[model samples]
Target: MTHIYNDPRGFKEDMIEGFVRAHRDRVRRVPNASAVMSSRAPVKGKVALIIGGGSGHYPAFCGLVGEGLADAAVIGDIFTSPSAEQVYRCTKAVEGGAGVVYSFGNYSGDVMHFGLAEMRCESEGIDVRTVLVTDDVASAPPEQREDRRGIAGDLYVFKVAGASAHRGDPLDEVERLARKANDHTRTVGVAFGGCTLPGKSEPLFRVDPGRMEFGLGIHGEPGVSTSELLPAPELARLLVGKLLEEAPPDADGTVALMLNGLGSTKYEELFVLYRYVSELVERAGLRIHHPLVGEYVTSLDMAGCSLTFLWLDEELRELHDAPARTPAMIWEVKR
Candidate 1:
């Protein structure tokens, strides 16, 4: 059973209470809302990079709010999209003279609500743009890639946009690079078990004993395939193969790799997986840049992992290498 909380219905609000309190120096509540914004917001001449999505994925929607990442996050309840009103508040709070760039995973509810917020911003004379991260290659076929869902690759897109914005790039430039980041990125994941929502006693789904599921969703959805649990090396081969297969032919041989643990997967297990993944990327004739191995995006205690590859050009590599200081990730610019 999922553990630790007060009232089941009050879970989201209580979590927010604890979050902002602990990170008071870094973030603050959006006032009468479940949203959060970087303490250092509203940089007068720069574009604002606002991100949002469901709760549960900590250090993501909220943890990403700081310099060189997200300027604000319109948060929502577990696995649910934030409301249109919430989106507007965060947008208005962060908009500088340049404009606002709204970035988030490609989800139906998020698309609907963020759209509503966009129209409202335009009517209010605030410039706005959007870049939806659709880097989950397993969600759709190559010919229909736009229909794919966004998963762990959301971080790459958001990070690039935030860095661009931080550098005082205009809204259009930030939006373009973020879309480009999404185009250059791919992710494939496997799950050993499903996650349980807060207040629920049973997991949303389950893998049979001695097996694992592949191409799974972050919100505990079933994957595309299930087979006997393989060793870390074989699992790494399967995931890396799918990503490289779908990568664009023009993709440069350099990649920013993210080996993410989906909640319950231990770090020691991830380190083992990363050892194999690092070798596989090298074997595929790709150079690794800013390779990360840990939980950046995650499901709620779901025991599994995913590998994300962001094939990079000179521009992408520079943006990624720039300094980024967030609650969960702190990357210093190379001297």
Candidate 2:
């Protein structure tokens, strides 16, 4: 797309080098591998969580690998799954005696590759488990929840897993808690425009100018349907309504609301969306225990946003508030 790139084949390496250069103090390239593990590794007997997927979704796999998110992240090319060898290497590199847990979105290629990596780790005597984040309601019917695709809900999984590890939770318990977070989270997104692949001249999908696609996937996969662009409040209401319908908050429940910027969406716009979402959620008789607003997860340069809600309990609240220092996520210890 009139962008800078020698060839499509070199895109991954180009991006990786740039990323390492930019985050040298916090992230380091995994030795003899195509992944980047956090510099703050070997977390003192804590369970290590490894996550990976195709590239182009910056801040999704690698950007989140820091003090409070993933311990290791393996990346493949744009919209492609990392090889089993890469996954195995990352898992081995980050594994502590407590073991390694792989958390990824539910995609056929990811499942196969990561599954193979898991088996390879088991053969090598590394205790490994996996939790797939499948919270996209637009992918399947309510009765077929397992078939749902994973979207922004992965942020919640990383938060729980990292907090568990930070608290010295054993491998098994970390896996359990991560699974719990995955089960209680849901995400739905919309796109005002599709994204362009590196070196490509045009976007993957086209939305009529001034229109938006509701329930859109990060990769420009078809959304539920198209509609005219509505005002920020109305749009928030419609999107949040879908999430509530799928996973309604408890009468007195507390939750963490994540307002994710797809890619090019401005912070001011996201805050506007959050303002309305918080109001609607509170009006529904539910408490928003914490609110995470920013570009925690993103597609390429797509212009849109996604909403993720995590129904929280006491334990989750503590975990959510725990101190975490990372390139993207930093918190001060609360006395």
Note the Cα lDDT for every prediction shown: 0.88, 0.84
lDDT of 1 by residue, 1-335 (tens): 46998998888899888888988888888876678888888889999998999987766778888999999988889889999999988888778778999998889999999999999999999999988888887789888878888899989999899999999898889989999999999999999999999889899999999999888898778898889999988988998899889777778798999999989898999999999988988998999887788998988798999999999998988888888877667877553
Number of clashes recorded per candidate? 0, 2
Error of 1 at 55 (Å): 0.7
For candidate 2, what is the lDDT? 0.84
The residue-by-residue lDDT of candidate 2 on 79-140, one tens digit each, is 88999999988887888778988998899889999999999999989899999998887788
Stretches of model 1 off by over 4 angstroms after superposition: 333-335
RMSD of each: 1.1, 1.9
What TM-score would each prediction reach against the true structure? 0.98, 0.94
Model 2 poorest 10 in a row by lDDT = 326-335
Displacement of residue 88 (Cα, Å) in model 2 is 0.9
Error of 1 at 108 (Å): 0.6
